[model samples]
Target: MSTPVGGDETQAPQSRFAGITAALRYPDIRTLFISTFANQFGQGTSHVIIGWLVLDMTGSALLVGAAFAVRSAPNLIVGLAAGPITDRYDRRILMKIAVIGLMLTALTLSGLVYFDVITISILLCGVFFLGAFQAMYMTARQAYVYDIVGANRAISGLALIGLAQRISQLIGALLAGTTILHIGGSGPFLAMAIGYLIGLTCIFMLVEVGDSAPDRQETIVENLINYFKALRSNRLLLSLMISTAGAEILGFSHAVILPILALQVLDVGPEGLGLLTASRFVGATVGIAGLAIAGDVKRPGALLLTTMFFFGISQIVLGYAQTFWVAVTLVAIVNIMATMSDVLHQSLLQLSVSNEQRGRAMGSWIIGIGTAPIGQSEVGLLAGATDSKTALLINGASLAILALIMAALLPKLRKL
Candidate 1:
């Protein structure tokens, strides 16, 4: 069960939970956690607002897909760059700067809306900018966590963050729908801007941790080349990335399709969409809670593979659902599996990688996570051509097949 990160054998379990609880109590972790929670809540709210705004303005599925593409394309382009930058700078400062950038972007978008000058192109550009900052901020934040809780307790720390994020999404999605109905799109943007500012302030107030030593001094190009070399050399890491990427492609590909599913397949309105979204968040919250309470389980690797299998099956069930409630339940189950898989995969990554290579390893991890949007766009195009349900079914079946293939090919993945 133990892989020798830090604590002694007799007290490892108690120490792990104690570290997690202490980290939660620390001003640094508390401020960081709260700031992240607020930011994530705003992110969930913006997801609904942006899609609705795009669809309302253009009334075209293609434009909505484009908007989603704009939001995610930065991950494909700048995700690698983010890791080096995160390692080079003080992460707390980097986080504060990113939050400021986000706040400004949100305020700018809101101003455009207020002036009735916001175009689809402008909105897309704003989304791209927002996503770029988010990528940088997340890279820095993930790296910073080791400073707060030490590498030994990173998984438990991550689990707590996941729990907070899920709760935020569960509340934020429903609130966004109602806020949009009552106060309009501009209202959500204003709220998002305020959230970013609040997060920034919280970040500023936290006790500063001195920077970790830079991973290695290489030119940006050399750093990138070294990263690829590392990735290529580590077959276990590469396989894990590939497995996760496949699952993400299948699961996240349906994000845009969900609204379509609500309207077309379920014949329920935006309320149904909100409920379905909330149900997934609820499930994730439950899964995170379970992980938190389990302390330190040894089977994260096998657990990840099993979770992916169930996640794929849930997607298939969701694709075949004939009613709103049924689809909601299926999506919730899917979220539960997906959440568990994510936590386990991340834990494995943190446990297995060397400290010096953490930034690049995490960057590579982001690359895999980021590429799912490409699949999302592909799914959107397919759904536009055919039915959303059909697209979901095809992607889900593909995921299940990929999971089985991975299990056969990489036996090490079954043990963490």
Candidate 2:
């Protein structure tokens, strides 16, 4: 059931925490928030663990990217279908299925590595399934948060979700890194599997869907066909998707080369790489917390464009950092904008469409971010052929230029 909205909300006692307090008042949102923490914790650790594993087993940057590429490839393939699917079914059921998939995959990967039977082929297959489930779960979760919170509280709901994700990801990254250093085994993957179990338990507590249920009765193909038809006239959404895809393909792909940067460039090994990963969440925490406190933004498009521009520039600067601390600081700053871009994209996309269409809008977001595999492959191969520094310079510049071009050419987007 949807939370009843009251006109009195405008007259409520206010504080910096007002937005957060109101959203958490719902039991469903609270449990879902906890699950978010668990889910992202697994995700944070998986990125570092899987990337490092592929690197260790193959000793090739291109292979590492290829592994990550296989992992994210599902977004492009399954994301479109996932949108209408989530809207058509009970999202709670979909969430459970995705979490279960995560649990089994993580457990299998852990056991394979523990028994010393793991190979590059097995690892690749493992990450591919992990990525597919993650794509479905993320798209559903994005729409479900709105289902629980209603439109009035969407900004805060999404901001709070971002907070949970960033903090847990920070802990996950640090723990995964430390686990590698001390246990030096499958402990990280085991921990990841357990995290999904915890998340699944939380899903059991969810109640009912909001009043704004499915918008129309249509088959999956008919629903998608209409959405695509809508996109022809929805310039703002098209622009949003293009910009989101650009950021994923360029700015966020910096992660694909972190292993190379840690070992060859910074010489800090796994521990330092963990710090680099943790710093991203720290930066994201700042951005998300600020958004939660700031509450609803009247004009988010301008801010979104600004964040994308800086996000791109920071990546370019990161390529030139020599010291470990300097690189860490740069990574943190890069993600501050990165997460802001993320929050803006999800919030704006959900708000842009009707209640019933929100899932498909988010599905478009999934499709846009699916470009990550392309970026990952490019960075990994370029680093192997030339250097991590050069790859960063190129991708970073392209992203920054794209942001500027969007701001200039798509004036409607900026005004949205």
Candidate 3:
């Protein structure tokens, strides 16, 4: 007997290869992806090298923290303007200029090391410039992805981009340690500069496929006012902004206490601390990969909320983890949840706004992430007063509680 007409689905299932393949079909996207990978790889390498270099120079934890802070501090100042600037200009040009700026900064820093003239003040100046360029690149890149693929394929496209960055980060981190061991501090800096150059080349080949937002005649202050005004009108976007900021401050911020917990509480020592740190990055890779495999989720907002809730739960358990292995597993779980949330959150945010407003929306989102330094300080103070474990436990519980409240209040976000 003949099978039913539509039921003759004997071909291989499509879900088996549900990762980056769809997005990779576009030549421009492939070029863009490569560029993003190179930049992220460079960032990963530079991160480790900068921290090590700072420690070697000053031999003080405070200075090391300050050095890293210099790299991140620009996000707060630049984030608000990033979206508006991205919306009003050609993303390709923005990225090119930004990448070029990054390359120059990296090379200058590398030259300092080469000439043995690297000073803390000079290093801070270089990092500040690096961070400023990164802010623009990030805002423009996200808007550009939507422009290229449109909303239909955006989730997979962005997921693919994230996967590339995550993998590159792992490679860069691994190479950083070994490169430093053999060739001294200059090795990683030069390597990172090369990566930036590679990224610049990729951007050079990337053809702009999306419409550029018409230039607004408004002044900077007026544009800033418009951005906030737009944000206020969309309750869903506003809710997402608040919820995301909350996650960063309450859940993500707890990471600041990890070093302390590893040393004082778990007694894991430096080796175990490395493992513990590495586990989270590894987990981030797995988490993003899982999202890529799933491709499009029917209910991204719900998935986002679930991740946030579970992340908080993971943190609570992590707070109580007594053994090194237990802490590692818990930290991985937390990262898995956090990464999933970020992927979903970003995809959903992109889908929620218009192309003209996309950059501004992203800028608002970046503010949430930019709150990291604030959260770090907050968690540090809390930990200082009442043990790291207690601080983590409180933050975790607070995240879960706050997420639930937001979900209940923001029906629009729940339905997304």
Residues 143-173 of candidate 3 have per-residue lDDT tens digits of 7876766666677777788878777776776
Root-mean-square deviation per candidate: 3.6, 1.8, 5.7
Candidate 1, clashing residue pairs? none
> CA shift at 81, candidate 3, in angstroms?
1.0
Instruction: Give the lDDT of residue 136 in candidate 1.
Output: 75
**lDDT of all the models against the reference?**
0.73, 0.85, 0.73
| Model 2 spans > 4 angstroms off | 4-13, 215-217
The best candidate by TM-score is 2
Ranking of models by TM-score: 2, 1, 3
Backbone collisions counted per model: 0, 0, 1
What does candidate 2 score in Cα RMSD to the true structure?
1.8
Task: For each candidate, give its TM-score against the true structure.
Answer: 0.90, 0.96, 0.85
TM-score (C-alpha, index-matched) for candidate 1: 0.90
Q: Write out the backbone clash pairs for model 3.
A: 83-359
CA displacement after TM-score superposition, residue 329 of candidate 2 (Å): 1.1
TM-score of 2: 0.96
Worst window of 10 by summed lDDT in candidate 3: 1-10
lDDT of 3: 0.73
